[model samples]
Target: MITMSPASSNINSTDLDYYCTETPTVAIIWCVLGVLCACVGIPASVWLLWVLVQRQRSGTSNDIYVVNLTVMDLFYNVGTAPSMINYIAFRNHAFVLLDEILYSFSAIGRPLFMTCMCMDCFMAVVYPITYMKMKRYRYRLLSCAAVWGITPCIGTINAFIWYSPIPGALYWLLVPTIAICDLAILYTLRKPDPSGRSDVHPQKQRALQTITNSFVMTLVCYLPLMAMGPFLRLMPASDQVKFCVISLLVYIAPLLGGIIMPLLQLHSLGRLRGLLYCTRDSGSSEQPDQQL
Candidate 1:
């Protein structure tokens, strides 16, 4: 609940800051959303990790990325949990800075791993022989290690630079790359094989559907924040309410992926019954956690 003040109303749009004065109700709402993110993210990541561990013997490259993705989500949920309390009872700015650093990790990590997942599928479908040639667990592990190494560097840049564009730039770069991979996958799958085969492999069909769904999820979770920069620029300086709403959505963006990813992985793998502890002997139910 922000009311327009005379000082703010008089400010030039170019010099206006991003901060919007908020009321107790707004703070409470943020706290509640943070609580929901932690409550859902923690157990879901833990459960997914447990499931992955159970199937590690036959896990694929995608599972390696999924493992890191889940870890990043857990980091986001746990690392930012303190901010919920700080939201309701305003804390020192230093605490908020630390939270922003943690957020930067998540912001980079989620899309980074998602891009890995898409690229993995891209190689698998588009170049089967080469994909198989390089398809070792160690290679995937190395890739994950590389992404982990990269996260801190970019995250640090975002943390120290006020209103840094690196995160958004990274997302913009990834979005088109992911789209091309998705389109390539779709095109490759739709074209008939030169071998005169009428049937697509069941696993390929499943993989296509899973990746498409993930791409959609990524867009849903991230597009708003990516678009926020332009929208904010067009908005008037004194429009605090819309600014606050967009700002909240940007803050909540990291959490959306954490909550949705686990459920998406479960559903795509036909393992929803695993949530109930109801054992199933079906082959699909026994499949490894491959979707991200």
Candidate 2:
């Protein structure tokens, strides 16, 4: 009679083989996309922030939310994009502390920023008149600062907990909570605008649509990784094939989302479209219109 330990019995030989042998085509794709994303996302995010800063001087509340989103995207691209490149090039090398730190920063920042964006949307929908009345620039600055300060602190604590012997219960809890919050924002938007406004402005509708798409994209990207966590925990020595599949699925979704978001925003926001055109027409001396 042959006896196998419970742990060995649970391990999938196929999963182990897959991870060891597969070339991680997904990672390669992610690397290419990551490089391209950095090239475009970084520059565009910076320019958007600059434009928002320019707008800020004139002092409008609406621009604050957009500016905050731009800053979030900027930081995300700057901090996270290089990690993808490193992972692709080095295959998860030991000397990737910078990549790890950037990855961790982004892991926290993305959700935090998304939550802030959702809150901004909720405020706009629920209190349109008040939202209009509020001095947006100060509120925007304060809100962004709070998010930046709070998320990193919480992330550091979570990282410590993660490294300890305790199970990663907090991560599981946080993921679901963030998902639920995003869903709530979508739900609130689905409700009729309380002002009995039958007609939605085209620009406003497009903005809302862009946000809705972004939320969906984020959920799609992260949910698989969340689901796979338990499987990984239970079968650490599982076969490489299953591991590769999960890794590819987990990474590709986010990479695709990161690529699509800026494009979606450009489609929705004419100002971004105009900026792109102006940049392309570098040598043209024609005066550009101030209004998007």
Candidate 3:
């Protein structure tokens, strides 16, 4: 009589064979996208930071948040691409350890930085007085430090507990917070002044719009993982479903973030280009001050 232990069966059931025997089409696609993402994400992030350092000495509070998110994403884009290229060119010789290490950081770092951006918008719109008080670049720098400090703890949880669950928890926790903040700002914008001037302050309205856009990115990109968490992490799925889930987590999501970063800031690219060229701001003030 043959019998299988539950743990043994579970271990044996992992279809790693399918993972290794990839189709040529998938490899080519992954390689192309990986290189394109890295190409665009790396340069854009670097130039943005260069503009921050050279042009905006007294950068507004939002600039600080943008710096943090851009830096984290640069690390993510640079870190995730090489292994894929290597995988395509040299299969087993690919430095997969790079992928594992970089993915670990990007996995937590991306959303956390995004949360800080959303929270910065929340405060800027909902608590304008407090936001005004936070104008000093040094203060903003210190606050960014606090956000960056979260990486070790998240990395620890990922190392010990699980990686994907953190994003799920963050979605549940932060989505409502951001949504409430957006709604509150919209409410404030709609209310009339003492003279019955029911007009939204331009900056406040812009902030609200950016926050709303950020929420959309979060919802579209991250929410599905929350729903899939139980099945991917706990319950069993067929090989195809499992592959799709892992692919989304490891590949699609990061590429989306890299792509979406530029798109979200498409408005700012004009000002950014001006800064790059060492030219005076032709219309920086007229442009929207923040990105989703």
What are the per-residue Cα lDDT tens digits for candidate 3 across 1-292? 0001111111223544323345345545655676787787787777767765664675543466776777777777786566665564554422443344455445556566667666666676567799888755686677678767766465544433323355457657765665566567667666667797767676656665566666666666566544554555464655444543344343455566665674456444355455555544535544566532
* lDDT by candidate, in order shown: 0.67, 0.54, 0.56
lDDT of 2 by residue, 99-197 (tens): 433443344555556656666666676678888898776877887788678645644443333232111343465556656655665665667768998
Which of the numbered candidates is closest to the native, going by highest lDDT?
Answer: 1
Following a full C-alpha superposition, what root-mean-square deviation does model 1 have from the true structure?
8.0
Model 2 lowest lDDT segment of ten:
1-10
* Number of the top TM-score candidate: 1
User: What is the TM-score of candidate 2?
Assistant: 0.63
Tell me the tens digit of each residue's lDDT in model 1 across 49-89. 77766677665424778878878877887865676676446
Deviating ranges (above 4 Å) for candidate 3? 1-15, 18-28, 58-62, 90-95, 129-139, 156-164, 190-200, 231-237, 244-246, 249-251, 272-292
The residue pairs that clash in candidate 3, if any, are none
Q: Which stretches of candidate 1 lie over 4 Å from their true place?
A: 1-21, 24-27, 58-62, 135-139, 191-200, 239-243, 274-292
Tell me how candidate 2 scores on lDDT: 0.54
